[model samples]
Target: MRLAFIGLFFLCTTIYAKQPAVTPHGVETPGVQTLPYVIDGNVKVFHLIAEPVEKVIYNGKINLLEEFVKKNNRYSGPTMKLPVEIQKIDGWGYNGNIPGPTIIVNQGDFVRFHVSNHLPEPTTVHWHGMIVPNDQDGTGGTADPVIMPGKTAVYEFQIVNEPGTYMYHSGFNDTKQALKGLDGFLLVLPKDGVDLASSDFAIMLQDWAIPEGSEQIKYLSMDRNWFTYNGLAAPNFPVLVVDEGERVRIRFGNLGLMSHPIHLHGYSFKITGTEGGPIQESAQWPAATVVIAPGETRDIEFIANNPGLWRLHCHVLHHILNDTSYFAQHQKNGIFPEGGLWTYLYVKPAKDQMTRASE
Candidate 1:
């Protein structure tokens, strides 16, 4: 316990007053902030200071994977390296955290965030799902890297747009970081507001790799070859619970660039929304799982039907492993032809495990 407290204290002290520029004579940078939830309340803000990152990928020289290798270096890409923070043994995983944090927001509101660069280079944020300006679009040049180290840039925009499941990530090197863990889920509630009592819930599915005994956190390595749902692999699956007889909505958002045919072992939900945002009518589809593509969003709703412990995961079993090779090496391995788990739906419904409590 003492060690945990000490670690937390050190992290707070460093980040609280962390000046840009990662190293001496480096680019002095500011801090990054973010807005947790965009409710109807007064303006609220949050922050995230991104520093330059470098990572290493150890590719396996076995099987078909070797065919994808480039000149002794199995891994070949524009940038396989990324800045990574080691785990502090308290909530902090190698790459900072798991499932990251739940991003909250509501319909008809405004959100302003100042993304500061602590790294020696440059970076920016892109509001993945929500509609914003070409500038607040949060990308490189399209918006702008909030200045380099030592400086700060703020992204201001009205959340005056569609809501549902959305995403936000480093638009600077989106093709890379965004695919990694640099992204989080965003929820835009309705005008009347969101109802936690019986209405909304969210789940973000991602697969990451943190090489054992290394300060570097590689989002995904084709070689490490481990997969997880919301960062959890099978057997380590999370149990989602709710009132047995109540109506419930499961908001599944796919932040990974790969498509996930998420199957619910038991309950079937209504495909109520898509990446384009919420569907107008209750145009419903009854299925155990739904196909969700990256940079895309989907919302599913269903009454607490045959409730029991259910498994909600990407139909891509390999992804159920690590998302590494599923995306990094073989694009074909990433594709789902003729509506497989990557296209169609799968369900394994059972009875509720919780006893009916007498009121």
Candidate 2:
């Protein structure tokens, strides 16, 4: 009986080891959605609608003002009153999501986009960091005509560039449209079909200027008070979960006004690629923080060896804090406090480690 049991154990182990690892196809954008596409013979077709969207930046039950006062004992003034409900702000987005949904495709594939405009003004989607025919570049008045309100425009192109991180945003009134959250990521993978990492994540960074008492975002204002990742502020951003010792990749895209120095705690990672494409392995260097400037994209990779919940946030003091202007007002009343572009990386134990521990 003992001999038979030993043989069965070895057979089971062999079968398990032979099973192919399920590879992830596309990158995940936590707190945001991905746009779906349909394959038609030789082309991938995607539809997008430009319209107004109400995004919830802060949905926690805790009142930020009260929490700020508690953390700072110097505040003796009356408590700053705020609504006791979720904070929803209005902005323009693609397909009903702030920052829009990510579009993923393999290199060498033909792509077509059907973009419909529902906004008050005309707009065009310029493919940033992508090399395509000038006529299909989606630059209003130069390469292509803008899509008027209630009208749809078609953009067809081939993925001629190498695998890399790219972006799409409004070409007409670029600054104003992007500031109002009309942008998204476009990830082009290699045709060879090799998975880059075990866990891949995409983060879209944006800054907003919303008046103290209003939910409408000020697209023309130079001052920004709220910073977000995937359209969510700090403490509200979705946590990124991975297994210990797994390879991880994070892609960041910035369409906001200011540059964001994204910092990751507990590990030093290598900057692997950018909007232009992957950097040679020999040229890649280790860094704990990478600065993503306006209209830029960056990709980083690391091994999640340390098993714990680590912080990944922007190093900009005000960018990590919510409603900087509101905090400033409380400071005038002797209450100074902190907290936007932030999330946690939860690395759990590997399956083998967990099994050994249980035994």
Candidate 3:
């Protein structure tokens, strides 16, 4: 289907600040908030911190991958960003940045994840896909506790798992953080590697609350229906780039508190896997889109069969628009409009893309 974002929308505010400093040991210590911001140029910002440092590393960025949230804990660094921050479900500091980042890895290769948080509250990062040990699930009761703020947690594991679409996000209080935009796509390519498809596509699903007036963020608490990609809302959402007839595989997931019936336009794909884990030949399903629940993920296979900037979004319309404010209502209805700095896809046709001269 060809989705058009042809509607008017008011603007919202973008909040930027320096992250606060933690205690000597990465536990909660008394100090002023010293945040960071992206001023100009292209910046690769990890939404979470994965490990800890003795003093300060990379402006609070943990360099090593660890499995624990404290220094000299279990796992170490690798490095990362906390995907979510608590804001009143009503408004301000609810969700994280859009399409946080594209975490690309190769099969058999390893990535050490250091998921740390600086918020007042506690949380953890759960690798939605991959063979994460029980200790790394990030649940207080099930695995780990809500990692205390000012702490670095490490989760080191291999991508020995097959190559497929997967996800990652805050596993503690998952619903709130997800709906507020704390999620991302994990692309685990094959070791030998297959061919086809454009460079590579990693798409994520998430929603957020972008308030209109103040510089603070706002997210929903419960009873939410808003939807988006990498935190982008209607019209402003990023356009996926592709070449017609190319074998395109989309790595998709839902970090929202609510489940999403991810629908794609134009063609269908093979339902490869769920939660980034491999889908055995017997378990594989085929469809144009798949249904992904919170903390769940899917890998879809399809041809760029039909090209023309086809729109990819959640089937839920309300979640795509969220009324008129975009950031209003704490995104209880949807996420922030996608325009600002987070436009994911911008496909420019290289062949047969331009309009031919009419007779």
Which candidate wins on lDDT? 2
Write the residue-wise lDDT of candidate 1 on 71-99 in tens digits: 55433444322121222111111124344
The CA lDDT at 5 in model 3 is 27
- Which regions in candidate 2 have their CA more than 4 angstroms from the true location? 1-22, 62-85, 332-339, 351-359
lDDT by residue for model 3 over 1-359, one digit each (tens)?
A: 12332222111111211322211121110111112233223332233552211211012122111211134432344422222221122221212334445565668765566566755567777776567677866665577667787876666666666776666666766555544445556666666554344434555555544443322334453434334444433333334555555555565666655666767766666876676466776877667657877677776766565544344556554454432343443443433332211222223344655532111
At residue 300, give the lDDT of candidate 1. Answer: 79
Instruction: Judge candidate 2 against the unseen true structure and give its global Cα lDDT, from 0 to 1.
Output: 0.83
Q: Let me know the TM-score candidate 3 reaches against the reference structure.
A: 0.59
Error of 1 at 133 (Å): 1.9
The lDDT, on a scale of 0 to 1, for candidate 1 is: 0.51
TM-score of each: 0.62, 0.86, 0.59
Worst 10 residues of 3 by lDDT: 23-32
Residue 198 CA displacement from its true place in model 3, Å: 3.1
Residue 37 accuracy (lDDT) in model 2: 94
Q: Of the candidates numbered 1 and 3, which has the greater lDDT value?
A: 1
1-359: candidate 2 lDDT, tens digit per residue: 99999999999999977865434645798867788999899999999999998888877554323322224444557644432245678889999998899998889999999999999999999999999999888889887898999999999999998888899998898877878889999998888767758789999998999987688898888778888888887666767878888889999999989999999999999999998988999999999999999988999999999876577889987787777787676655533223378777777667544431221
Off by over 4 Å in 3: 1-47, 50-96, 140-142, 208-226, 280-286, 324-359
Of the candidates shown, which would achieve the greatest TM-score relative to the real structure? 2
